[model samples]
Target: MLTLIQLILLLFWTSVGSAGAEKLYHRRDRSDVRIVHANQARVITDKHAAEVFLSRYGFIKPVNWEEAQFEGSASAFTDDFLEDFGDAVLEGSSQHPLRNPAWDGKDPDGASQSFISALEEFQRVSGLPVTGVFDGATKEAMNKPRCGVPDKEVDRNAAVDPESSSSASDTVNETDANRTATNSSVSADSFEDDAYHLNDTDGFDLKGHISNNTSVNGSHDGDMGNTSASTHQSQAGHRRKHHLATLISKNRQRRDVSERGYVAFSKRLLKWRLIGEGYSSQLTVEEQRYIFRLAFRMWSEVSPLEFVEDMRSPLEDVDIRLGFGTGRHLGCNQRFDGTGQEFAHAWFLGDIHFDDDEHFTAPNTGSGISLLKVAVHEIGHVLGLPHIYRSGSIMQPSYLPQESSFEMGWMDRKAIQHLYGGCNGRFSTVFDWIRKEKTPYGEVVVRFNTYFMRDGWYWLYENRNNRTRYGDPVTLQIGWHGLPKDGVDAYVHVWSRKRDTVYFFKGTRFWRYDSENDRVFTLDPEGRRYPRPISEGFPGVIGPIDTAFYDRRDSHIYFFKNALVYAFNVGANALARGFPKSIREVFPAVRRGDHPDGHIDAAYFSYTHGAVFLLKGSRFWRVAGSRERRRRLPLPRNGLLPHEEVGEQWFDICNVHPTALKLKR
Candidate 1:
């Protein structure tokens, strides 16, 4: 028999184990809830219904039932089915055979070879078993709610295998190397681990087929008739040859640039709006606009592109227009199927229309369709991304269950970057601001914030989050009261046992900051007046320094001006002996001839990484730190690492539209 205390402990452990199991079960359950809306198309009940579903979604060419026969049950085909099918396919492709009714009956083996091949292709892409029959599993997959965009385009000539892309190997190698090198020094939070591989050679081409009114529609229709038994048996011999030929042709053309293409906007900065006439009835106008803004901002975070909501601009002037409507709504050429599998559709490099019949809701509502996810996916199409079949990709044709912490995956980021390239910008100053704070538990904590300034604006980067604070780029005057309106050249925080002070420099002047008061000091404790010259502050250092940073390890301030670095000792209030050194000598490049030799922008020592970074133009080089020394490698002390794009290291430091400079958090 167990003691009383032991029995209590056993009960506690059992409950804890059950709770962990429940959490795992909950996640698995959520993933299984793929369909958002309750009223999606019903399951395919018979062979006739399967044929119509397949035909409508660009599987087999629209069949002329009167002239053709299949091995399945014979049922009368309707003209309405053919007309709806024609409209749906024609919205995206002009070359669809159904566009010319005369060619519909030309293929005698359409019910056999073409039908089976289409079924297999659909099954393959939908992640189902390619049995080439109307099975129960296929019926279930066909009934799931998916994007209005077709899974397969009638005009798409080739399929690019993402595994074959060169970038995959490069990305894997770089990630592994970075992980191995920084494992001891960097926190897991600083690195994004989710990997979504993409094809590097596939470019989103914006030059082709600039249609002003093209749309991609998704819908379901009634059942159609089947062909006679003899027709299917007669064509069974050709099935293997036809399927093999199709696969070979696709593989052969995969690398052909002309075969793989998409549309994108020509310009970086684009305007968008939620038209008043088509706002969602389910959400308030403010809620709708906020969701749209966030969707656009998500894209802006990864690319150089910037989006500004233009409510007052003429509809035509806006680069992209978003709206919500039901059947035959929004002046779109295509009509939406009321609240079924098709939720919304977008024109390439054009407008987006959401089906109002669907239950669109705010993010993380847990039950309804996420308008934000839908909006982001649709906007991707407008920006020229096709349906990516990879799991975790935002561009997937079918909607996955809402993840509360869903973000744009790496593959999606690379795909968009392939079109517009990464975000790049120059910073006037970059520094990590350290301060002491008291917690509620009466514990003292040392905290720091990283900031980047350009021109008159500044952005506070949340190091833990690895992103800038949303709605950043606030003016310097607002962030640092009594500072120059045009922005500062550098910031240096000098901290030691006896002294802890902060200084901001711009042009020939420097200002002392009172961290306690959060403003520039007119008169310091040392009786120094405001806007002191560099010569007075540090006797041997020159005025108008390019950039400066205080090194905690050496207790000296290194100021970069032109090609020289001046090291000033804070304790002595003078330049150190052998102070002036060539920038290259002080911070030698690890790679030969890869240094930012002169005219440095900002020298920042990051507390998080425990290293100094030299920023110039759009690139930055990291200086060897204590971690590198501890490894006992052959790397030189203070040697500069290979230059990397600043945008890649510090992500989403993007500018917002001038009109949206004060966006609400």
Candidate 2:
């Protein structure tokens, strides 16, 4: 009978090496071997082999060979071994998925083309001959099942004890030896190695080595000793380690959870909850952790929820708390709050606080509200989130401010992305967003009808429209109530003393606003550059959407409704001048060859305004002023160049596509 030591050495020499062991069999290449002799190899491949194998090792469930292949020659045995083998897989073995024999080697082969490869792997992990064939040694090792050692075995004589001989003690018997080996948990190594504990760090090959701690024989002992002798010996002194690192604690409010250690734990849980629902999330693990840290800190003065991680933690004193200051919030700090739809304030990004007192409301005040919704919104604020204007956003400031947590929404996620920017993936993959301090509004504050974006849609100053000769000449106050959808009077139309026209009359009502200082009145909407490009302190300029202008003096922003509409307004100028001059910069979508000049792709517009003027099959503008309103500005150069800076009044826009920037001269 092949001794366990001999069989083990057979495996190690054939497979284990610095370059990793290779497999002997693959699921694909099995039709090759017709005969394999292993009786002397102690590998019982007969009809009774499986039962004998199970009886040896008490680990995992035993095989139900009700399906054993009792036909053919060695083929029957091989098939039986394979079937029993599938059972071992169901039971997770000591090797782990990574070290599993199935994964061994660099075979450019498949399950069919490499039974030898798989067999090699099995031998390597099982400590048998990894010769790429089901050698008698391999079959013997596979028959040796896995098992745990019992205390009784610790006191028993050695497995090879010669004095304890009995009728079952058949020295040349392969089945008996395999039985002893499987049941003995300790390979001569585990029972003998002096350094096999939790703290051992020997075989750790961060960049090298195969596996740690394997059983091998010694000089006086038999065959297993030479089996990858070096590797097993090297790993004999090492310990196993798992890869998770300690989480962090961040005081600064941010939207990641990983950095906040304990705090991150809560935030991550919250994110998971939101994700479970249909809500869109824009926070990442890192950002969520940051906010969670703050929440943990601030949780002191405000107890919204309990800080219970798992079922463990001292519950001796139901009221016991951690850290300084206490009156419930546990002395944690409660710092900021928000003002309007633009920003919602919070103390710490992670902590959840509440007031059991009177009825209150927010942006400004109030405490008692939806715990989840408030927590979500405040959690955002804690993460340095500015407010998003999307009507459906969670941070839109339209919900009750007192709630501990707010619901998540698509808009809320977008606003977060705008500030911090995102991976540019499906809106779903984005996480805690960041926002640089960039105000696109005025003294009072005014955002663009829509964002200009990384896309240079609003890069120019005055890209006036082509004048259409029509209607009479008259002048009057020009303004719009809003763009409400219902049948309302004067709300969805643009009117001037001349004849009012509804240019972008489509959907939704909105508030009207202007930047800090730039406003004036003009008889023509397109022909004149008020204060001309020369008037610095005067209302700078007004142009269609997608206009960008370079100015050391003022902020240059444009407006758009359907097709791009960029409005250049300095609130101070508007408060002074009766009306600001509005220009129409229209660029229609074009197909290849449509324009020999290769300009104009698609038109962009906002859904907020009341004036949409379609110029032609391709161009459309907000039709206002007299029918004789002339587009006096020089036409543009078609696209943005590398070293060009757009003037405050003379900007550049994509006359054709949003991606292509056009310089309006």
Candidate 3:
């Protein structure tokens, strides 16, 4: 007497089988499996099918021990910490390495040995150079998520009803029917009490989860936005969060650090609503909104996640909400000290409440608390980021102000990217994990700027002084060192024995910078100084230049705009007679109409190869004198650039070395 819905649930459970031996129906080829429901076949992956079954039965996805395994080798320093920092941070646990590995769980000796064995297995499984020791690489591998399971604390086992005995034929042979189910099923409604429960008396009880519990001293009358070096050093002395976590034997039940609680959204696009009114009268509503918008944008700059505002929705219905509150408001017992005490607090994938009593200031300057800075930190919490121990990180528990600059630190980027990866099919690990190939030439450092060909962004880096140092990032609007702010359309570095300069071109205008002198001067068509229109700089040249480079052998500059290549003598600053020839006419390998855009994006002279490379999209053509010699650079066997496959945006070339061009490491 089972209903149609009950029959479907039963069929799904039959397919999933028992807990310990969870069935993974998706093949390595990523093809969907076909299942018959009411005599109709439908295609779905095992994970999706499991999600559907859970939704139908109103049960949370089960917590499976197998999902806790770390997948790949950890190369990053943070990766090492996360991998080995299992459950020692749990509130009630004492299983840190400094302390005893034994916790409440049984098998003390066995657990200790198992940990070492597990570390070895992790190294081997992660494809690390196994030394059976807790090496750097092995530690990083432990931090990454595996088995499609996130780092968040998810309780309960998945709910899938076993099918009727008559439906035995529907079960697949690959599934283990005899395996044991570790956890019993619980109803979804009951999960609410242990989840996010808001009490009328006590404020919001977020299942007792406090992502980062960094202690904040009493309210400071002085400005909290000072980013002075002395202040920074003082703040560094403050207690920071540890990477410790609690672990209980093979069960591996764990918790993150006190000030480290990160939650992830089930969906990519999170919709949010603002519940309460303005927290402080120091700034206008528009100003506050602008501050919040900037905060959200700061995070979006690095992560694949996105947030949208849903103005016309209930706070509870929205994915997340923000508003101001006072003591006892919304059951929040933690009262705000009217002065510049606790700025605000937020829950994981939940509401953000500002202390309405705190004196707030929109600008970073001023004695009052910087509302913008606090907003940025609070938004980090709303976006599932816990309080990070790193000082430069936006997720850091305390705020250190930089006069005006607002950018996510390297740790922040790495952390978020680790969680959700980057957008636009980026973050490939193909080439990054491979061992470096020895360079034919001596070792050289490649300054791989991410904004290689980006329209408006640019940066400078120098590594000769033992350590890498670079100027702050700037956009086209704020030209650096006398360069035009309009944006650099094309650029090149001329390594001449007499004079070396980095040239930047925008529209018909160009500028040359002397790295030695730290001076920039406008350049005419010829290498001479003084600003002039492109037409005047290079006689007979029309339209914007896509790219330009000076050949050391010929001592002439070649300007590439669209399909046309215009050559100009450096000394004369005048075009060669009958110039402006089509690239297809000069280089036979370049098809006449190959690119729909009919333009060469970039070109550079390679001294190692003794040739010039003309870049178009993902492919490039290597060419020498005239129509005599030309050949397209070989595309990778896998048909992806090293940088592209390794999830990097820009290809790095160092010292004009051929080995560097090959990108072995």
- Predicted model with the maximum lDDT: 1
Distance from true location, Cα of 195 in model 3, Å: 28
Order of the predicted models by TM-score, top scorer first: 1, 3, 2
C-alpha lDDT values of all predictions: 0.68, 0.26, 0.44
| Distance from true location, Cα of 627 in model 1, Å | 7.2
Q: Candidate 1 or 2, higher lDDT?
A: 1
Local accuracy of candidate 1 as per-residue lDDT tens digits, 270-341: 889898899898999999998888888778866778898887977767878899988767655456776757
Q: List the RMSD of every prediction in angstroms.
A: 19.9, 28.5, 24.6
What TM-score should be assigned to candidate 3? Answer: 0.41
What is the overall TM-score of model 1 with all chains considered together?
Answer: 0.63
Q: What would the per-residue lDDT of candidate 2 be over residues 574-655, giving only the tens digit for each residue?
A: 3223223332223221222222122112123223332222222222333222222234233231211111111111111112
Clash count in backbone of candidate 2 = 144
Write down the lDDT that model 1 would get: 0.68
Task: Tell me how far the alpha carbon of residue 54 in candidate 2 is from the true structure, in angstroms, after superposition.
Answer: 64
